[model samples]
Target: MANHDTETTEKLEKFGKRLKELRKAKGYENYEQFAFKNNISRSQYGRYEKGQDIRFSSICKVLKALDVTFEEFFKGFD
Candidate 1:
């Protein structure tokens, strides 16, 4: 259970890093600006970037905002 928890945390962190990278690549220097533009809650988006857990539907919304497909988002992730 401990190992699983650790793995989950690591994955979440990686996801957050990837999200930030994509946001920068998309020309959004600030997460708040991105969130506001995309109609996402700025606070929640900040939490997500800080490696918090997010729902699948919310992730889908984020992906749409980022203009990335699931495959593209998860491309280099294990």
Candidate 2:
């Protein structure tokens, strides 16, 4: 349903925003630097931080690179 799609999109965007904030807090000024340091593709990481859909496995990898636990990553989710 359209509503479901909208909800998913909203959740993804919120997650992306949170990811960006966390990255900044870790002193990563650019996505390329973060991705490179984490062994992720820079373009893919950019997309992830831009609210685009990303794979769950990739999300896990990013969380690991950020030194964040799953619970910490999903904190404040509604």
TM-score of each: 0.93, 0.92
Query: Taking the tens digit of each residue's C-alpha lDDT, what string does model 2 give over 1-78?
Result: 133487898998898998999999999999899999889999989989988878889999999999999899898899
- Candidate 2 lDDT score relative to the true structure: 0.90
TM-score of 2: 0.92
lDDT of 1 at 55: 90
Q: Give the deviation of candidate 2 from the true structure as CA RMSD.
A: 2.7
Q: Give stretches of model 2 more than 4 Å off.
A: 1-4
Per-residue accuracy of model 1 over 1-78 as CA lDDT, tens digit each = 123487899998999999999999999999999999999999999988988888999999999999999999999888
lDDT of 2 at 30: 91
Best by lDDT: 1
